[model samples]
Target: MGFSRRVGPPIVSAAVATLVLTNFAMVLLAERASHDGHLFASIWPIALTSTVAVVLVMSFLFRSIVEMGAELERREAEAQHQALHDQLTGLANRALLEDRLEQALCRYRRSGEQLALLILDLDRFKQVNDTLGHTAGDDMVRIVAERLRALLRDSDTVARIGGDEFAIIQARPRGEADVRSLCERIIETVGEPYRLGEREARVGVSIGAVFAGPDIATATDLLRKADITMYRAKAAGRHCFRIFTEAMDADVQRRDQIETILRAELAAGGGPELHFQPVIGGDGKIASVEGLMRWDQAVVGPIAPAEIVPVAEECGLIEQLGYNLVRQACALARRFPDLSISINLSPVQFRTMDFPAVLRRLVEGEGVPCSQLELEVTEQLFIDHGPLCEPALQALREAGFRICLDDFGTGYSSLSCLRRFPVDKVKLDHSFVDLAARDQSIALIRAAVTLGHAMNMEVIAEGISCEAEEQIALEAGCDGLQGHLYARAMPADQLQAWLAEAGKARISDAA
Candidate 1:
């Protein structure tokens, strides 16, 4: 249309000019013929013939120009359409969706109709990308987009906002029920299996929804609120939808606060402290001490590891935190030459390609022998991270550091991990110790101990909080015991004093 508007006038003017020039020439010829005494009938006929021929030629030229303009307009329209739509899925792009959302809001304002915006993010989408490559990931996105479009009304707008994310503008929804039912349908459709070439891919969507009301003023606000709601759904669990709520906003604010505080504390070099929990050998001596992080905030007081660790991981502070703890633990271990130190490894740390080198540098700088340092990793590392974790673990083992599989028997592939990795010790999770009174639990623990021994690995029963639990662990033939029944995690000075007393006790018993 734009092209035609710009070029149509010039073509029409050229045709008109040619016709006018032909008319003027005919008039001149008639005058000359009259002056030369030619017959008026013959002159008139010649003039008429010339005028008709010029008019026909002009008409043909005009029609050709009009057709050219029309073709240009058609191509321009196709280009515009392509620009506003996703090339992969043919869904509306963000720009088009935003424009449509604004239009929808305007209609709602005039007619008092309700409009709902839903933002969806696919769950575990990265797994597909990591495992199957981006081509498969694109295929999955295309499949999901088709499913979403099929589930929506013609009046509704579904868009691919970005990778693994989509948005929908639902026009004139009846109420919450209507919005929720649409969301449910979208989730169900997306949850269905998709065949990407030879592989079967599956993923679920988390949806956040917001409706036009007193709170929503523009497309941006609607989209932001819906996004917040969608994250809440993800937190609740994927394959679900959540409506925007005031409480969710508060939770987001609190998390932001926590992350800010953590960053500030770490920057100031006054973050979580490293404490040691004694891991006693079966012969009743402190064989090694496990380093535990303790965060005592001035505002929140003492935070649990469960709460603090996730915050660190989410905010990308886990690697620094883990490294700092390891360095400090190594420095502290130097104070007691015979005491080996164990520190927990976060999955974030293992994900780093240079984590082994980083650990070596920290230990070497602290003047602690690598053999005296034990790195503990949960079974989830193998299950969640898979092959990416192998090189880091292997590198650390090659550096002369012992690797302990923490919370063993808690994961599905624990035995596989044992077979694949060079693990020095296996720490039985507390659940088994708690349920040791049951015959089956004891049998499981005993089997784990026997397997550990057969593999030439030490087996430690953790969370031995009672004498009965200790006795059960001993009976199960665990090489070590660790829990509150022995001693709580203590500060450096306290742990040092306790280690001295235990050493003396061992020497006296030998004497």
Candidate 2:
């Protein structure tokens, strides 16, 4: 195309000039020959032949130029389309979507009619990508795009703004109800299974929507608010939608503050500090100490693990946080060689492909025996991850780290998980101990303890806070009891002091 553009014009100009000159020379020759009177008819025939030949050559040259121009036009149109559309899903790209949104916003301001902008992020998309490969993930995304196109009005715009992210512009939304209805349809349609070659994939969408109004002054504002709302939807447990509110802005700002503080804390060498609580064995001795993460920042007062973990996970600091805990546990393990140091594991940490190997390296690097570490995980980890957790758990067990199922019996499939997973202990959820007065609760506790014993696993009752609760747990045949009843969680140095005191008491009794 470049060559033709540069060379074709000059060549065509030269050809035209030559054609004119040749015709003029033939006309002059014919006129001069006609003056001779004897050769007039012959000269006319020769002149007509010369003129026809020149016209034929110029016509072919002009046709070639026209065809080249058409080809260039077609290619330019294609390039423009490609630039404005997603190559994979063929939906509008972010730039085009924003341009359209800005146009819609202008019309909205003029007409005072509401338009809606929605941002959608696919949940579990990464797991699909990691497990099934990008090809299948792409197929799933395209299927989602098709469903979105089908579910919306022809006037609506659907755009693929990022990997596993989409945006929708509802140009003529009647009201908030209309936006909600659209979101519901999108969630239902996109959640349906996608068949990608031999494999089937499933994903859910979290949507955030913002309506055009006084608050939304520009397209960028609308998109930003919609994205924040989408995150709120995800936090509420995906496959749902949330509308923007002033209150949501406050929450987002607070989260941003937390993220900034956390990063600074981590950069300074650590974020959350570890506190240890004793787990008293049935034999009347301290069996192990569970490492509890504590963050008492001056700015936030005291942030619970429940609050910190979600933020860490969202900000891509979960793996780093988990490793921090492991290193702390390892250091503590070295300090108290005889006692196992248990730490809770997040589902995100467990599902990482390199989790087992990385964990082995971290533990070995610290020179702590794997047996001195017990990893606590909620049953929900296995329930959510299923077969993916098996090899990781097996690898950890082979490396001699004990696996404890935290918050046991809360999930419907706890018993099933016990049968399948390589769990060495079950920590009775606090709810059972809290309701120890109920006959059903006592029976369930006893049954859990009995089943655990039958399976040759230890059953530990957590959250015991009173003498009565401890007695109940003991009578229920728990192998261990932990909670405020024994001792509140304390710093590692304080726990060392407590352990030393307990050792002296034991020595006095032996004497």
lDDT of each: 0.85, 0.86
Clashes of 1: 1
| Superposed Cα deviation of residue 348, candidate 1 (Å) | 2.6
**True-vs-predicted CA distance for residue 302, candidate 2, Å:** 3.2
Of candidate 1, the 10-residue stretch with the lowest lDDT total is 502-511
Worst 10 residues of 2 by lDDT: 502-511
Off by over 4 Å in 1: 1-61, 105-112, 122-143, 174-176, 193-206, 210-218, 228-247, 264-268, 298-304, 311-316, 435-441, 497-511
Alpha-carbon lDDT of model 1:
0.85
lDDT of 2 by residue, 254-331 (tens): 778888899898888868989999888877678889999999998878878877898888898889989988999999
State the lDDT of candidate 1 residue by residue for 70-152, as single tens digits. 88888988999999999999999999999999898888888887889999999999999999999999989988988888888
